[model samples]
Target: MLYQITADGLVLFHLSFILFVLFGGLLVLKWRHLVWWHPPAALWGMAVEFFHLPCPLTDWENHLRHRAGQAGYDGGFIEHYVWPIIYPAGLTPGIQLGLGCVVLLINVLVYLRLWKWRRTD
Candidate 1:
């Protein structure tokens, strides 16, 4: 039971991290100081998706689940959780790459705005 709770907490944290990677730049727009953090996180997020690298968060979550006597899933957190809800067609390599591109595009646009704002200030 404790393991299962831990696994659930990890899943929540993993999801929150993904959200931050995607939109943390918007926070930077407000906080300004967050500029030092969001870009690298966004880049890492894109790299993981583009390279098809395994996320450590997913691995840790799976390990906790297994320790709790639950069967671990075969893919990353998004594939196991978010993809099913958003894209019932299932997750493919192409889709993963596209998602990575989406992340890159979003952060690029956000940072561009940030740059413009800073210059005007």
Candidate 2:
């Protein structure tokens, strides 16, 4: 029971982290100080997707699920939790690279705007 709860918590955390990586630059635009945190996170997020690296959070979630006597899944958090809801097609390397590129592009645009705004100020 405890392990199951922990697994669920990890899934939530993983999803939240992904969201932050995708849009955290916007948050930086508002907070300014968040610039310190968001860029590193965005890079890590992109690296995981672009390089096909395993995310530690997914591993922890699987470990917890196994400890709880649940069957552990084969893939990452997105494959296990997100892919089913959004797309019937399985996740592929091409899709992963595209996601990474999208993340990088969005952050770049946001930061560029922020830089321009700062210069004008």
Provide the TM-score for each candidate, comma-separated. 0.95, 0.97
Q: Specify the poorest-scoring 10-residue window by lDDT in model 1.
A: 83-92
Model 2, range 94-115, lDDT digits (tens) per residue?
A: 9999999999999999999999
Write one digit per residue (lDDT tens) for candidate 1, span 5-67.
Answer: 999999889888899999999999999898888888898899999999999998999999999
| Per-model lDDT | 0.92, 0.95
lDDT of 1: 0.92
Off by over 4 Å in 2: none
Residue 35 accuracy (lDDT) in model 1: 83
